[model samples]
Target: MKITVLGTGEGGRLHAAKLSELGHEVVVGTRDPATTLARTEPDMMGNPPMSEWLAAHPGIALLSFGAAAAAADRLVISGIDGASAVNALSGIKEQLTGKVLVDYGIPFNYGVSGPHPWPTPWGSMPTFAVLDSDSLGEQIQRALPNTHVVKAFCTQEQATVVSPGDFNGGDHTMPISGNDPEAKAAVVDLLKSYGWTDILDLGPLVSARGQEMYSHLHSAIGFALGGDRRFGLKVVR
Candidate 1:
């Protein structure tokens, strides 16, 4: 499988490396490959630069967004940040047509202060830009009408997501929502390969609203767990 992870962030790098380890041809997408390779300092989240990561992991190609999307066999994991996702993806619409786009981003608007802000070690927690009525999944699906967008992985950290067995014998639940059943199934298959045993089909892109909105609670849980513990939320049915 030729997979494209469309971002240079920590999450994107994790997916790219893991997918490569799983024997898939992985390509990471960025706005400009040269600029990404030129970075010397860590990213905002303190992850090592892309060039540093690429040097450590060989054979994984890094390309421009359009080229990366076009190179994918069928799947694309979008790790682009929420604020600029729509615009960045919209620019490469043609390359993504008819492909399954797995969106795991929360639509967080850090610039706008929430009505009641929750402060943390970093700063005040960011508020959702699209809440209650709309979601980033729906927005991406609309932006690329021909693309199949399935929402997954927003509820947990990327490391935990790619390797669930590291926590609680992989007993946690992974919730996915999308309008297209086939696309959702493809994403579920990917999750299974990553060792997920309890994947919940939350039904339709609208369900992404709840999946994404859970980020606030997720943050609270992290803080309660001492801010660095890796834990999973299980749906105890």
Candidate 2:
């Protein structure tokens, strides 16, 4: 599949590299194409010389602010903060029409310091305020009604989301919710390509509220477990 990965931070670049390694044609969309080019070269694995890395991966496309949204079969926006994803996609809503968007975002307020606060109902977990009334995924769907949006990969930490390691007990499940069945299947196939064999369908886009909140629990677990981001939860029979 021809994929355009938007954003140049660790999450975005990691996905781009993984997709490229999986034999998919990947075009990286960054505000500065030169920056992406410089970071993806062969000799630059450890301490990549900024100049050489840029010179090596010429296939990486440098997109203007709005160009990334206008191009590609699928757009995976990562690395950037949640608000940036909203702003970026909002600007290119028209271009994203009728496309399948794989949304992997969480509403986390980094500005809120000192003690993690739980903001949901007694049994509920806190999520980004945007998700309180309407989730980001739903908002994106609303903004681009023609676009098929599937919310997955939001519950797991970046490491677990990318490489979920082995199935120790029962199959580790990533909850996926979408209004479009075909879009959900497409995302499932994408996850399978990344070695995920077990997926739990949480039903409809509205279930994304639950899924996003579930991620908050995962975050809390991570915090309590001493900042280890590699662990994941499981449901066994």
Candidate 3:
């Protein structure tokens, strides 16, 4: 299976490495390959530059967004930054046509200043740009009507999503939602391959509202857990 992870962030790097370890042909996409490689400073999250990660993980191709999307067999994990994802992905709609896009982005409005602000170690807590009535998944689906959009991985940390078995023997639940049943099934299959045993079908892309909106609570939980702990939420039924 050929896969393309569309970002150079930590999340994208994790997925690319894991996918390659799983013996899949993986390519990473970014706005510009040269600019990404030229960066000497670490990312905002304090992770090393893309070039360092790429050097450590060999055989993974790096390409522009359009070329990466074009290279995927049928599926693409969209790790694009939430704020710019819609615009960046919309620019390559033709290349993404007829593909399953597993979107893990949260529509975070970092510039927002409200009356009551929740400040974290980094900065003020980001408010959802699209919330309650709309979500990033719906926006992407609408923008690329030809693509099958699946909402997943936003509700949990990227590390947890990739390796759920590390916590409680993979007992926690992974929730997925999308309009296309077949696309959702494909994502579920991938999750199973990653060792997920309890996956909940949240149903319809609109349900992504709850999933993406949970980002704040997810952060809050992280803070409560001492910031460095990786945890999972299990749906005990």
TM-score of each: 0.98, 0.78, 0.98
Higher-scoring candidate on TM-score, 1 or 2: 1
Off by over 4 Å in 1: none
Q: Candidates sorted by TM-score, descending order?
A: 1, 3, 2
The worst-scoring run of ten residues by lDDT in candidate 2 lies at 118-127
What residue runs in model 2 are displaced by over 4 Å at the alpha carbon? Answer: 32-59, 74-79, 113-127, 166-170, 227-229
Candidate 1 lDDT at 59 equals: 93
The weakest ten consecutive residues by lDDT in model 1 span 110-119
| Tens digits of per-residue lDDT for model 1, 40-133 | 9998989998898999989999999999999999999999999999999999999999999999998999866678878887888888899899
Between which residue pairs do clashes occur in model 2? Answer: 37-53, 37-54, 38-53, 38-54
Residue pairs with backbone overlap in model 1 = none
lDDT ranking, best first: 1, 3, 2
Clashing pairs in 3: none
Q: RMSD (Cα, Å) of candidate 3? A: 0.9
lDDT of 3 by residue, 1-237 (tens): 999999988899889988998899999999999999999999988999888888899999999999999999999999998899999999999999999999999999877847788888777887788999999999999999999999999888899888888877878888998999999999999888888888999999999999998888888998888958888877888
